[model samples]
Target chain A: MTLLAGHPTKVGRLAFVDQDYPIVLPVNFRVHRGSVVFRSDTGSKYMAAAMGQKVAFEVDDVDEAWQEGWSVLIQGMCHEITDPHQLKLIDGIGLNAWAGANMHTLEILHHRITGRRIV
Target chain B: MTLLAGHPTKVGRLAFVDQDYPIVLPVNFRVHRGSVVFRSDTGSKYMAAAMGQKVAFEVDDVDEAWQEGWSVLIQGMCHEITDPHQLKLIDGIGLNAWAGANMHTLEILHHRITGRRIV
Candidate 1:
């Protein structure tokens, strides 16, 4: 699929699968270059990144009244950023740690990204 | 946390984060030992597993009138089961592939498990 000229302009849901079941979370995001990025603590997302695995990122805008919606799907690799300076940069950019544990302060890392838009 | 005597009896949502946005998917799952397992095809979950990352598996029950809910959170590593024998075994278990693409026939892999229950 050809890349859109800018980040997707709608909010969407993301689903990650383990076994046959899917774990879903809601998110607000932006796409830069060809990669999709988001932030989280030492929770599930962190675990996925640590394993150096490719993940599915999805965004959708659905209108139940009209039963119509558009979605974007992202398939890519996850990377955890451990560099203290980078972590500081992420923190500086207003990515707050809302996770309920002290273990959430780890630095923001970049994810190796690739994906396509499904309209 | 202590292991529960049996699999969790409720359904939950799983979330994976990239950059600062979260990708969420709803799932039905079970806990065996310390791992949570489910099934999906060559879509998002497969991508995450290919990266060998840890993912979050969450299940919840909520009562809108009471505004109460209990959530179970799982953290673990994802491994793709590429063994043809294992693939056949998983396919034999009635795990039907429903993804909208032909690339979804990859075998079911086992996920390394860990998690906690929050009532």
Candidate 2:
């Protein structure tokens, strides 16, 4: 199994603006070709991708017991994978659709990633 | 210790618009009088609160072992607690400043909270 096959903290929050409302929703994601990829089923996230919106995705590992953690934030443009060749390539990336069935693949492209450690 | 004193997942992602991009940042938060409260220094979050921006906050409890979790989403207006009396009252809420010091208190007011379980 690849390290991401069953990664415990694979879930992160995807943020985007929908009609002037800033929204954040948790998503299961994986890294592919230096971008964040996830599956969504015609939801807000999917709509954001379809609209080619700029978004922020955040993932963190924290030990609340010790009050410490590090977080990585990525800002990028969302793109829905539609090309058959690319979709087939992404299918081999070992990412699962943990959210639901009938999903579409989306990736955050041109990522500007940053991380901070809270010690 | 109240349930939140050492809650393992008390940290959540606070989302709001900065410029034209939607951004989400991890925050250690607690519920105070039906509002979500956290401490932040002068940063993007602080500016959002000062502007009374409408924002969304998301917190989730996930079990990657079982691929199940529940997330609560909150939509509200961010308020910076500047009133001396209110600040003094919030000081006793027991929510630690897990990130850093010299923090200012902010709360999401008029919460419209909703939750969903993923199985």
Candidate 3:
């Protein structure tokens, strides 16, 4: 397993399974202190995490010309950010959420992070 | 829920779980006949899917300058492509693999696809 060298892009995919179906969606994100952070509406993702769901966050890149790129995967426990200090700090980061205007902050506490780069 | 207008980028993330750990990773892909396709080595993803695991594939784009983008997610059943005709057809597509040299083709039989655009 190769360790990712730098910061992950602010955009990536969040994956979780609800019932028997897998749920995967793109999320605008940030990595703060080894956790994956993003925003979600008062919908499936938020409700799942609020119920102490485990989730996966992944990001990858590819160059069609070079035919190479890398993929990173992180597994963690998800929860809503209610701590005032953390919320205030993230508020300062101002991750631009494009999908919904009233989305809430969700954080994935990292349990294992593993990645492999083809480039 | 909005329908995606065009082709998803050739790269995205694949999310699944094993032993209760959420696993998300980037994958080089192609959309053919309304399904998500990619490649993987003889690893966790492959082993898990070989056992009939359901998976999620997602892709999105973000423009930092505009602070707008779109994300798409597809839920599906994953399987190795063994049909010669299908493999030959996909061979012509030639989706590139960058991170690993000895990767094998894996395709997601999409069951549900949903997206939201922030732009």
Instruction: Encode model 1's per-residue lDDT on B1-119: one tens digit a residue.
Output: 12322323323344555453444454334343334444554556545543454456554433323323344455554555556765565555443222333233321133433343223
Model 1 residue B57 distance off true place after TM-score fit, in angstroms: 1.0
- In candidate 2, the residue pairs with backbone N, CA or C atoms under 3 Å apart (3 or more residues apart, or in different chains) clash, namely none
Rate residue A72 of model 2 by lDDT: 77
In model 3, residue pairs whose N, Cα or C atoms come closer than 3 Å (at least 3 residues apart or on different chains), thus clashing, are A118-B98, A118-B99
Off by over 4 Å in 2: A1-7, A43-50, B1-7, B43-50
What are the TM values for chain B, all candidates?
A: 0.53, 0.80, 0.82
User: In model 2, what lDDT does residue B2 have?
Assistant: 39
Better of 2 and 3 by lDDT: 2
For residue B59, give model 3's deviation from the true position in Å.
2.1
Model 3 spans > 4 angstroms off: A1-9, A43-51, B1-8, B43-51
Worst 10 residues of 1 chain B by lDDT: B1-10
In model 1, what is the error at residue B28, expressed in angstroms? 5.0
**Candidates sorted by TM-score, descending order?**
2, 3, 1
RMSD of each: 10.2, 3.7, 3.5
lDDT for each of the candidates? 0.42, 0.73, 0.67
Q: Grade the docking of candidate 3.
A: medium
Top candidate, metric DockQ? 2
Compute the interface RMSD for each candidate structure: 8.4, 1.3, 2.1
